[model samples]
Target chain A: MGATIGRSIQCGGHRTLWASQGRSRETRQRAEAEGFEEVTALVDLCAQSDVIVSVCPPHAAAQLAEQVAGTGYGGVYVDANAIPPALAGRIGELIVGAGGGYVDGSIIGPPARASGSTRVYLSGTGAASVAELFDAGAADAVVLDGFFTSASALKMVYAAYTKGSAALLLSVLGGARSLRVDEALRLEWAMSIPELPARSDRLLEYSGRKAWRFEGEMRFISETFESAGLPGGFHSAAAEIYRRLGGQADESFPVAHEQTLTDLLAGAEPAPFDPTR
Target chain B: MGATIGRSIQCGGHRTLWASQGRSRETRQRAEAEGFEEVTALVDLCAQSDVIVSVCPPHAAAQLAEQVAGTGYGGVYVDANAIPPALAGRIGELIVGAGGGYVDGSIIGPPARASGSTRVYLSGTGAASVAELFDAGAADAVVLDGFFTSASALKMVYAAYTKGSAALLLSVLGGARSLRVDEALRLEWAMSIPELPARSDRLLEYSGRKAWRFEGEMRFISETFESAGLPGGFHSAAAEIYRRLGGQADESFPVAHEQTLTDLLAGAEPAPFDPTR
Candidate 1:
């Protein structure tokens, strides 16, 4: 997603710089394929760039922000990862406290490989300027007139359904399978919710491939729900669902639906509730 | 729902007998409107009926079954409530142990006011006979070729998503409202999931009215998930969501969406995790 976003910025005629010191070979290849200038050190990348967009897994967003903050380079910092609103706000404070401009951003839809397929929602102080960088590019950049954390809040809530419901459908299918009523449930759904059986099949095919990334995102969403004074258990359970499928992330092809269902059932031991997580 | 189902059975040219001694005035009126013969005592109703169908709140299913068992009514008993498969199995055992033919049944969809909109799934020993009772009636009756508990298991997984996703959407909307990004989130959803904003509104208006009933059903679903060797937290949290809105069950009309949101936010205290519940 980061490489694709960089490509979008480059399409707008801006020079995009990336630090590949600790990134995977695939990450380096993807970034290089997008023609992004690679800097060997984080400090060098920070010093050379006017704007730094952080797009990584939810777990890595804060650490990357801290690393950029440590370099003492005061530039427009865009945190475009999926994290809780409070975490986005804290990251904003970290960046602004270091004399840098902060923009809370979240990427919606898929990677911006085609026009109108994705949106980059920007909020906070430098949002407009960052939006300008994606002008007429593949990713439609929308500047939001709300607090800095609103972008992250929007992302959290948006995925709260799309991904959350996927996890839920998977869990339901798994439960039905465990109870030996999977076929009956499918036939019943066909008469009512006609879309569900196919949807469940698609979730089984695709979700496990990305479950590793989604596990952390679900936790962030759980925290986001808790911070907003709602129960966090939905996404917390979704995280457990994804964690069970996390092993399939490295598979070369989409794991067979039955295999994924077996994996899910094998990991059915309920995790102890931890409020502190 | 019970009265409606009775009406559907009556439409099939069967005499419907209902015990209205402990029922609410509205329930009695509904039953009378359906032309069901009212029996003053449950034992009398049990003694006169060839087959008894129990359709009540999920929490009351067990108690009602036990009461019927105590009557020593050696007739066909159909447990048609929204309950876990295991509970359905237990109820089936109690009925069969008392020298009665047990039919595991579950009504899916809404009250059977019209054909094709609702179905009553039946399994077990007297399932075919129970299905025959609804022949050419408002609710489509289908008998499964599996264990008796398959009917309840199907209902558990089916509602686990339909109602579970509704609770989730409400929570996400409430969370967005709490973060003061409700409008932004709605706008984003409009561009992505066009159905959500109005769906959330409908949920806020309608879900609260039936939340009291659904709260118990959600817990049953949670237990069903656990019994099927899956995490139960999704529906457990959904139960909490419905519990928050349980106050609206008695409203004269649909409560305003904002009031429902406020009600949800006000009851956001996290409940302790109870594995035993």
Candidate 2:
């Protein structure tokens, strides 16, 4: 996502700078290869760029926002990470307190590598300006007419069925495997509920390599639901399902290391519940 | 199920008697309507019928078997209920100790009201003999080559997904409703996962009136999975979802009292968990 945005900004005739202080060497190389100027010091990057976009795992969203805010940057800050509304609001306060304009952004589809499927939704007063930064036709960045947390809320709810259902399917299949009647259950499904056989296969294909990434997202989603006064047990269990299938290839498409539904249910251990995670 | 078996027995030129000692007036009337001769005493029913089939809720299966065994029933006893294997084994012991031949039977699909789509899987030494009682093509009563608990095990595992997935989807939608994102979530599912839009509708339709019946089945499935060393939280949570839906009209097809997904998540309160239930 970062590389896509960097290439888009370069195509729009704007200088793009990335702060690679604690990032991997591969990430630095990818940013450089995408025509992004690399700056080791956060202060230098903060001074050079007019706008900054933070895209990382949900757990790191708040810490990254704080690091960027601590640099006393007064530019527009866009957070395009999967996070809850309350957390986005808190991050909004962090960035706004440091005299920076805050824009809550969420990436709905896949990364804009070659285009066509991604929509970057933005909210807040700085949203339109931030959307224009990536308006190079590689991706669609739309400005929503709402406050800071609206984009985050949309993302959280959107994933409740998208990635959330994956966990539900995994839990049911895993439960069947544990009971030693998975094959019989599959046969029964084939006879009556014909949608499940194909749905499970599609879920496995789409989510196998991405399970590791979805763990934290599900955790944040659980928190979002619970904080809204709903039961979070499903997604809490879902996070554990993803955690069981830890450390994937970090790619959207399934690779050789990805596990199918049968292999996932058989190979991975059901991790014990830990709400703190 | 009992009605179908009674009809098949009568069609085969055999007499069928039902023990209606503690049954409701409506059930007795239904049995009479279905051509079953009603006996007010268990001993009388046990003496008259060569084969007795026990079909009830999972919670009452063991108690029903005990009651029949107390009458010193020497005939072949078929326990056809959704229950855990351990409970079935215990019931088998109770019947066998009382000099009665015991057959474990699991009814997959709906009640054998019509001819198609229902299977009666029977297991144990007397399974073949019990299968003979209802082999008149009304329903397929197959004798599985295994111990008494095998049939019950199959039923428990099959329902872990069939009914278990219903609970998962309900919990997710319920969570979204509580978070005030249900409409948004539904719209997203419609736009992205076209299958979920139809699947959610089907789940709501099938589970509306039968939520009361599935509560006990899910509980037994949870116990079966937990006994096999799997996490039982999903089914345990699912049981609560059904419990929230409360009692229904006890019909197979959708009627006037049925609740759609929108009505269910909106009208039904999220009941607190009670493991004792």
TM-score list, all predictions? 0.94, 0.82
Model 1: reference contacts kept, as a fraction = 0.62
Candidate 1 CAPRI category: acceptable
- After TM-score superposition, what is the CA distance of residue B49 in candidate 1 from its true location, in Å? 1.3
Docking class of 2: incorrect
> What are the per-residue Cα lDDT tens digits for candidate 1 across B177-270?
8777789888878887898888887888888888999999999999888867788889998998999999997886667988999988995654
Number of the top DockQ candidate:
1
Cα lDDT of model 2 by residue, B105-133, tens digit: 88887666666678788887878877777
| True C-alpha contacts between chains kept, each model in order | 0.62, 0.21
Clashing pairs in 1: none
Q: After superposition, how far is residue A161 of candidate 2 from its true place, in Å?
A: 2.9
Question: How many backbone clashes can be found in candidate 1?
Answer: 0
